[model samples]
Target: MGRPPCCDKVGVKKGPWTPEEDIILVSYIQEHGPGNWRSVPTNTGLLRCSKSCRLRWTNYLRPGIKRGNFTPHEEGMIIHLQALLGNRWAAIASYLPQRTDNDIKNYWNTHLKKRMKKFQTALDSSLVSNSSSSSQLLSKSQNDMNSTSLRSCSTYASSTENISKLLEGWMKASPKATTLKKDQEKEKPSNENTNVVGTASSQFTQTKVEEGECGVISHEELENFFSFENLNSMAWEKSSTDSTPQGSLSSLNDRFGTMTEVKERSSNRPAYCFSDKWILDEESGQVEDLMDLSLDCCSAPIF
Candidate 1:
């Protein structure tokens, strides 16, 4: 057998610690900064085992612990970091200053894991909704383009004299026109009311097309159709018509844009967010997967 248990079943106490025990442990730690647990009970005149004394100091009596409920953003960071790092609780705790690994581990088991699962479910639903909306928009645009193309072809087929010339010119120009149209479609938003649609359209045209193409009525027409100024004016008109204050769409867009950028960067590189090697599997004793993804090691707590 493996040597014998340290604390045998005799007068040794366990369970909820008493006030007297708390006071003794706190007093001992305050006076001497917790080096060896084996000597703690003997030196401090406490009846409890050295293991109990050490546990009390590490979990509760330590200074600078911000106890109580965690904020939503902090919870979010913890969940994200945990997924990347695994169960390396001490490492995870280091990122959250003043939080103990034991506390974090308990929180994860009791609360955060469930909350993260719910959040992930909601996120999946949102992604599905967005994808469905995008498909609907693309279908609508395709139908409209097919109808327009049919009308154009019929009109060209009617003219006898320039029929051959028109067909040759159209065949040559269609590919370029199709490319421009695809670019415009990609740039345009399903929600024409948003500032992004206009701004994105203008930028897309300016950067993707040459000066000559930019001058084309199709490009100019698209720009005018998707202009942010026009959308803002429309929003103001609607608000004025309704006798309500025009809600600031610009502010919402600004905040959303920043969040989107940060999310993109985080997804591209997870190492930046982790404080230590996250545990992937406790049973298997596996570490967090670290690929080529660039992590921001500067923000991580030193081991």
Candidate 2:
């Protein structure tokens, strides 16, 4: 169907309004206060249609109209408000106060639209670059940590190995160290059984507090022995159950998995390690020792 005409076309003048027509329309609106478009031209003695007169007055001839190029601030406002309200130019115009809906709509089409396209393109490119840089930084950090951990692990392994060799040499040299000392009395010779752990001789750093009894280990001996012994037991226990490279890798992954899981479940986890009675390590039959610092160090401070 042919669309109905916007106005009666018989006696109406269409297209760009003249200065005289602008004066007439302005004069009529100022006198009557605008509305009733269909009769404005008739009442004002203008030769334009009601629609043209309305458009002219609303778009151009209205009082307090600020015509010409839009300011940068105005253009920005249009783009921002447009994202929320879209092409409801009349609604957008209401906020600007001095701007008209038709004028704003034309400015958008002629100028801001093209500028926005370029602006959006630059914004997207910047976002992509930021995303790529973030990924690279994360990957680099992980690689650096892996390299550090491997280095520290190798150093620890070397230290423990040297301690092991030293321990074996000391043991072989002291076979007679576990000897039974005889207790002598004035009346009769008595034999009392006493088993000493070791009697590292004069070359081996030992001291006896009293006659016929072994003294406790020195601070130096305990420190050196505990350092290697504790770590050795932990590594051995983990490796014994793990059995293969794949199992070890899986266990490492599980450690991280458990950490993230605990972080996500912060409400359920204990505030302090000492507060918890037991912490089960993945499907294990026996509870791990509290002194196993490896588990707690990794588990806490995840957040």
Per-residue CA lDDT of candidate 2, range 183-236, in tens?
111211111210111111110111111111112223354344224243333333
Best by lDDT: 1
Q: Pairs clashing in candidate 2? A: none
lDDT of 1 by residue, 1-303 (tens): 886665564666777666567666655654454567888777877777777777766666544454545543334345444543345466456456556678778766656554434433443454566443433433443343344323322222222213323333443456644564466556443433223223333333333232222222233543443233443333333223321222332332232333344344332332111111121121122111111011122111100
Q: What total of clashing residue pairs does each candidate reach?
A: 8, 0
Runs in model 1 deviating more than 4 A are: 1-4, 123-303
Best TM-score goes to which candidate? 1
lDDT of 2 at 108: 67
Relative to the true structure, how large is the alpha-carbon lDDT of every model?
Answer: 0.42, 0.42
TM-score of each: 0.41, 0.41
